[model samples]
Target: MNTSKQRPVRVAIIGLGWWGQKMVSILKSCGTELEIVCAVEPNPAAGDFCANNGLTLAASYDAALARADVDAVILATPHSLHPEQIDRGAAARKHIFCEKPLALTKADAERAVRLCREAGLVLGMGHERRFEPPIVDILQKASGGHLGRILQIEANFSHDKFMTLNKSNWRLDPQEAPVAGMTATGIHLTDLSVKLLGAAYDVRVSCETLASDFRQGDTFSAHVRFKGGGTAYVSATLVTPFVSRFAVFGTKGWIDVRDKAHVEAPAGWIITRASVGSLIEISEVGPAEPVRENLVAFARAVRDGRPYEISGEDLVNNIALLEAIIRSAASGEVVAVG
Candidate 1:
């Protein structure tokens, strides 16, 4: 491991939207470990603000990408644009931490991954939920077999219309947020379920747009059949009050993860296991830190030290499943994802 704790990472933040602000804030507030190389947002207001705050301001992402001063980029752009952004960033040989729904198509995702691999760059999707403390614990236990051959997993995410990715933004344009709202969330939920279930096998999905004003998919449900006959259920909605819940059901016991804004707490997971006489509650918060830890992991990988605990392969698979869900929804039938 590169114990060079003094080494700082030069990073640029693209897009200054809602989530983009979080990324920008996390990078800027990371003390000395994260150096703000540039701020690239089409919004002049945002760029001017970042520049006023001592960050190099770029008019566009391409300008930042062309700069050799930056070693990495955090892209919290919209979903449909992820593929092109990732590919272009990889070509520039910049380590990447991008938002979920890697691409509108699996082909684009595969291309982005291949390009990054060839460029010898780290390409991490912003599947931030995966790094949530409770979710991490649940996955660790599931992978360790402590969940006893996980039989089923459930994922839920609900947000009000105002919180929808495309609610008031350009994301409402199908071309900009393809696969509709599915990419906005199905990407995260399905990917999460697969991680806990071990593999994304067969998937049957259905979707509907409940709101007349909503641009794309409003709510979706998917039934995923994993290897070893395990089943996983996934769902996302834009009409409900905010509720985030994740659970894994195994032959021996089950694990549940729930959260709202921060989702899982940094302290640890509020884990529950059932027994004959009583229900056991285990609070296991592993290593304090929330979203920042994921950024640190990315920083370590960018330094070519130890690879981030999560690999690029896991990200690619998630995109694959994401593509299949869209296909299933589009075709009104089940779609298989490798």
Candidate 2:
């Protein structure tokens, strides 16, 4: 939370696509702590959206970066553009909050982190699942040794939301999206795995086009081995009805969480737990606006020099695992993560 003494973080949103527009709506609902001063979208049709939202529509990303009033920039741009945009933001001396799958490659992710660190700028991520109440509870239990000797995790995040997208959309492009549903959905699972089980040592993945026209494939399943002696199975399918689940297994106890709706439209979560000498327990966690929580934390970091939840090392490690997932899917062999 930000103190009233601190001024709002004026931001220029770098895209006006579905997720970008969604960010605008979330920030508006977040009150005056985070202000959208401008927006950069190539599509001229977004002019009306900017006008209605009381935002200045910049002609280009460079124009937005050059704005003196813009204290930070939130990137909802394509995956390939993240590294360069982060570099530019650091050069402009503005704080940055980038959408997930920060970069498609490990080197680019590392470079983005380095540039931001060198410039003493806050680099925030779009992994909102970390802020979810249920996930936070799980993390606390695991770290407190209540779960005891973590063994494995299984997670799946799938939805048919992208099925209506045009075939030529960048999200469906092989060069842009790469492996199946990994970029759009599976990456979030992997990020959660890293947060719970530390870095991955290797991964084996299979990507197949089951029902969608996406050239890269509509589904992918990844088997990851963690360096800290645990395993994780993370998967996603673009053609499936909405499904989000995560289970953590440990020596003492295990927990299973099932979401009734997407994070953007949270309904509730069913959590089941079991322990060595106790009866299985089931509880329900109410809905939460994690996306707004994540963005507000980023704003607070920029305004008060507070630390963001995801560390730079964690950011790079997740991208490293993502790179391995892509390679394993391509070669039909297990790939090692560095």
Candidate 3:
């Protein structure tokens, strides 16, 4: 979508962890729209990753910001650091593409978004599920009135990475990942629900530790009431095997997109119509590469001055929903989303 004839964007990648490295690898084959020219990582092991990948290792984010060639920054750092990193990147007048949740709190998210708006810089978040093909298909049908008055939606995304961890990590901290699985998995479905069902006004949640060696819990679920009269239920567990599922029920029909637990597996879907006799099978190979597509979308937005799909209000609303979910879980009462 970045139809500009300008040269490719030279980006500085901060954080060289697993997700950060994944982004670097994707950018290698991510075409001519963007390029990773430098990286910042304090870990000595990341030095070899940078060297092997022909990237300059900067001592700190300030060093990366000082480079004139570095047109933007891709933040793959922890969730808590996003607000400050985005603030610094925006201050430097560099386009920013930060990984999701944006910020754990509504105020932080709003401030980060406001800073980018005032700086006239493109701000993109890593809600990559927006680029998934099955999601696109469902959205198209809903928009076309084919789904016919979407009544309710349900989704569940879970994985066992928390149970698999033996050593202490940031994810185990309540400050970093409060609400446990909600921050890790439920947030993705929450973003999707926000995009599809509009802003949620009331939230009721149940979060408990079923099995975990860490201080945080392993299971979480939330029921949300949208301002538009739609309802949604989302659940996740940190001790379960990998699984991702999304379903929507409407007056005319219903659709279920079941994604394989493994990241490498292609997602499939099934749709059932009230008038039809049997469930319709929709099989498709080549699930949309969400991470790659999200990067490209950000590149296009930066290069062409195009608007990113998720609006500023959506960012704030999503965080409000997250905060409300946590509050409800703690209070055992339905919390009103601001």
Candidate 4:
């Protein structure tokens, strides 16, 4: 509603890891509305990246927060530090856009969301899969009754990139990435499922590590029972070949979506009706710059008072289900979401 298209949003990128660099590239290459004014990274190696991109390398997060030019902060830091970083960013009256999981625990996520709301700041989570064309169609049809009553959903996001990660990598640490692949890839499915079928009330998980060299577990599968009477399954693996698939099953028909492990390539989807024929296929070949769209959305919220799509309650509920999955895997029992 704030038609001020000329307004610029100054943003700071935290963390200088591979994923952080990816965000930087998207913002620079896609010509989005966001401007990367500064970056908070402790690694001296990232100084050149900052210098080349015209971003000031802040000595610390506090230093970045103190800057007047920064209107929002995109946090790509470790999961352990998300809650504290979000709290600090909100306290500084800056909009916060954090990568998925928000926080590892429900308590931390609730605190982060609460502080952001209390400070009247936008809290955006980086679950960009919702922006995918196929995913958009699924959500649209499901809401429009084309999919009838949704009964089940299945999603699996797996890649072999983790196989090369070293022990020092935080993702290889259990404390940082729990329930095997849940934190890395499966969380997207959980977020998407929650979007389709309210919050999950319980979770049953079976995860294990078959690779002896892998620091963290390599395989994970979780079954979620939603409060809205829908069931979902999410699976992820580190040793398998790259594959990404999502499907929604309904009483009348089903929609299946598949994509490459990388985002640069196009994705395809299929809609099936028992009486209509075999299947209808749709291929999306254009660039799917979800990260850019996500950043632009955040900027719109900051500049024009437009609400960020991900709400505080949704953020808290996402982490709640994640915690339940982790717990279920550990105890080998179905855990009730808190």
Instruction: Give the per-residue lDDT digits (tens) of candidate 2, residues 30-70.
Output: 78679888999998889999888888899899998888888
Local distance difference test, candidate 2: 0.90
Q: Which lDDT tens digits does candidate 1 get at residues 203-322? A: 888878776466566777888886657787888776777677678787767877666343333344445555334576655444445567778778877774667665556666777777
Off by over 4 Å in 2: 1-5
Ranking by TM-score: 2, 4, 3, 1
- Candidate 2 lDDT for residue 168: 73
How well does each candidate superpose onto the true structure, as a TM-score? 0.88, 0.97, 0.93, 0.93
Give the clashing residue pairs of candidate 3, or none. Answer: none
lDDT of each: 0.71, 0.90, 0.82, 0.82
What are the clashing pairs of model 4?
none
Tell me how far the alpha carbon of residue 160 in candidate 3 is from the true structure, in angstroms, after superposition.
Answer: 1.0
lDDT of 4 at 212: 44
- How big is the positional error of residue 81 in model 1, measured in Å on the Cα after superposition? 2.2
Q: What is the Cα-based TM-score of model 2? A: 0.97
Off by over 4 Å in 3: 1-4, 264-279
Which lDDT tens digits does candidate 3 get at residues 291-310?
A: 78888888888887777887
Best by TM-score: 2
Candidate 1, which ten residues in sequence have the lowest lDDT sum?
A: 260-269
